[model samples]
Target: MKTSLILGTALALIASAGMAEQITVMSWGGTYSQSQVEAYQKPFTTETGITVVSVDSDNPAIPIKAQVEAGNVTVDVVDIEYADAIRLCDEGLLEEIDPAILPRAPDGTPATDDFLPQGLSDCAVGSIVFSTVYAYDRTRFPDSPPRTIADFFDTGKFPGKRGLKKAPKALLEMALMGDGVPADQVYDLLSTAEGVDRAFAKLDTIKKDVVWWETGAQAPQLLADGEVVLSTAYNGRIFNAAVSEGRPFDMVWDGQVYEYNLFAIPKGAPNKDAALEYIAFATGTQRLADQAKWISYGPARKSSAPLVGLYQDGKTEMAPNMPTNPDNMKNALASSYDFWVDHESELTERFNAWLSAS
Candidate 1:
């Protein structure tokens, strides 16, 4: 049923492109969405006169799948995590994007080589490299800080409520890593049911004191309000809280789950051609570099790294705080898109069951 619906949508979209006027892009809301709007949407609009309608979602991929399955596709392009990008492409919910459509670099390098290894796929193009990192309020843990993944689960040592996201993706990996599973071996161990149970068992230690956050802004807010002592959050969100807002928070880079965010065209889009054009223009070297001014996330294109400069505030250097920074990469684990693609549904069910259990 879903396959037929997706096929129908794709054919309809191909036929409607000439008639459709504007392209709608769905993205994770808040400051991150604002960055894409400033860097890509508006500039694309200015350059081609095609209106880029921006929409917000907790995660765009959810609705993209729903819409494609229902054969009621509305959004043209969506900014989604790498795992979902790969999963949806395999499910035939996205259009196959060609490498030839992407723009060449200023130095004449083709898009295929200029983009980092994680940036390109048959159905999507990555835009940024972001991470899930835990942070603590300095005011709460002044004498000793929560430095490692193990420290995040040590409620006896830390002695405060720990904040975590509601979803299972990174939290499970963090639990495994916190239990002394080597960063490189987290996914391998998690491939089995015993590993899944082990992760939940580790989380059980802190479950009573855990405050779950659903949005990127909520983690930092939880710390600032004295609600949680340690909270896992995007590195950029913590950076904004600690640096931009003058908060006393510090990011814990150990056991971080770094991942890519890709821009993919849904299977049946209202403006298919315009969506392709938008992706090509937005992922260019200058445009991707421009996105970093609004957020600390590293651009997907390697050529854009040299072009990245100061933050919007003009004083802060964006490189030092990026998740891709050399200093932060030592203990980081690249979130396995393949692992989640194969295990997401099953693990998510188990995670929810664990969440509701006594």
Candidate 2:
């Protein structure tokens, strides 16, 4: 009888293990994903026993839309830009996320109040505040480094290949700023056809010297490998390359275009329950701050700031390196989600045509 009981318990344990929950999360690859793995995924798995499968994508939004529309949803969670999240949600491709699922701050502040105003949405929860900024090899510009956005486009003076993202989003805005447009007026100007033409005209100045990158990791690599003297990159990638890998890369924040990166669950996700659990855990007060230690992106939750300290190296301070730092924000531009939502298709189409021309 005792032997029969033991066999039955063993069978139950095996079945439970077979049914264990796991969720796949997709995000931009490189150090950014590594930060999430250490600060969010590891702890989440430890606390809940739900396995997390981290996947890398040049852009998560593309595959998310494709998978949902095809009725073969694979990723349960995705880290997407603010504009993409709104666009996807409006298309009914994402699951509606309730803010109540988020945990309150340690001081008893509601999570809704603690997160930055831009962090929460109908279907998304913000994760980090990162910037699309340009960086240069310190060795390349040791004597007279580029200081402003205009310098990035002044190839005749700087005289080297430039690294730029193939997309129009931040590129257009930076081009306009480099042409002397103020950060506040960038979107207003881009809203017009003449403004669009002007931005492209500025880009025309360095068209022959541009080397394009499609992925975040490639931007830093391009600089390290001497493929380009200067590159527009996610600020955190450049930070990781310098501090972690000892690459002599330095960022130029003058025209930095900053945006919130958010987490969302796709509609019809295979493990929606686990996905929700993971997002709530990952965006909590502590987890958001912990992420800053691994990368320079600012935490999206206000309550998380005090918890943030030195980098994973245990020596480098994380604050001044953040894109949100007042020093960095002197000339920084907040990415306008409304503008992108209204103009992305038109601008992207125009950009493609221009890239293919001549």
Candidate 3:
């Protein structure tokens, strides 16, 4: 009888172990993370019988480097910005994502040809295209609202605190744009010493009125709480706040800097095969399209565009709200991943110095 009981316990333990195949994915938290959960993680788990443990970070890129260097890898997959993906891959901290492993389109087009340009990189696969757009609370300015990024920096005219990311990435680009640099010439202007100085000088104009945010969640919260009347946020955050939570925020697409968030498997990741499999599955045509229903960020795949429709509310048409919408792109600038990859570290140092100056 004791042997029978022991045998039953052993069988149960083995079964539990088999069923517990797990992968931890670190992502920027809030609705963006929730979108991934709804569109990818949950579906991946259900289909692959793999448990996904979701983790949040102000920026996953920062911690991924630390984890890889320390050789104490806990995360299997991380969703990070494109520049970080490129930088990390260059630093030998991330695993290469072979384009061949990616799922192709239904028309039998190869993944390379199917994905948008720069969508598939050596170390990462582009997941979604998000943007940094300033949104103002309609209740704050019912009549004269900020119409452009220039207006966001005009404290005298706007007369309210503004929220911006603490990082230099999008802010510098927008600052240059607000200073009348053409969208096409933003990166070129930023490349020289003069261009860098111009961006910072422009930033100095409204630095005092700017409330800096470190996390994606903090942007909309600042606007909601009136800590900031206008906040530069990921388009999806403001969209979710306005659509889901019934906030009175409205977006300013002018001078918005759009960029991609990608999924990169870190070196020494515990479940490398499962992580790779998850990326392939998650970035597939259906999964990318599915993500749009949960978040307004456009999918990286061209095929997914037609599949995108109304938001979760079913009343608001999602097409017009996307960062990739043609109308939205009129005055927009793509955040230069190459520029950021080249300058991220130096810019971080410069920003810190400037932040500490006054």
Model 2 over residues 169-286: C-alpha lDDT tens digits?
A: 9999999999999998999999999999999999999999999999888999999999999999999999999999999999999999999999999989988888999999999999
Across 267-299, the per-residue lDDT of candidate 1 in tens digits comes to 988788889999999999999999999898999
- The Cα local distance difference test for each model comes to 0.91, 0.93, 0.91
RMSD of each: 6.4, 3.1, 2.8
Model 1, residue 121: what's the lDDT?
Answer: 89
Question: If scored against the real structure, what TM-score would every candidate get?
Answer: 0.91, 0.94, 0.93
Best by lDDT: 2
- Model 2 segments beyond 4 Å from truth? 1-17
Please, what are the lDDT tens digits per residue for candidate 3 over residues 60-107?
A: 999999999999999999999888888899999999988999998877
Clashing pairs in 2: none
Clashes of 2: 0
**Would you give me the overall lDDT of model 1?**
0.91
Candidate 2 displacement at residue 62 in angstroms: 1.5
Better of 1 and 3 by TM-score: 3
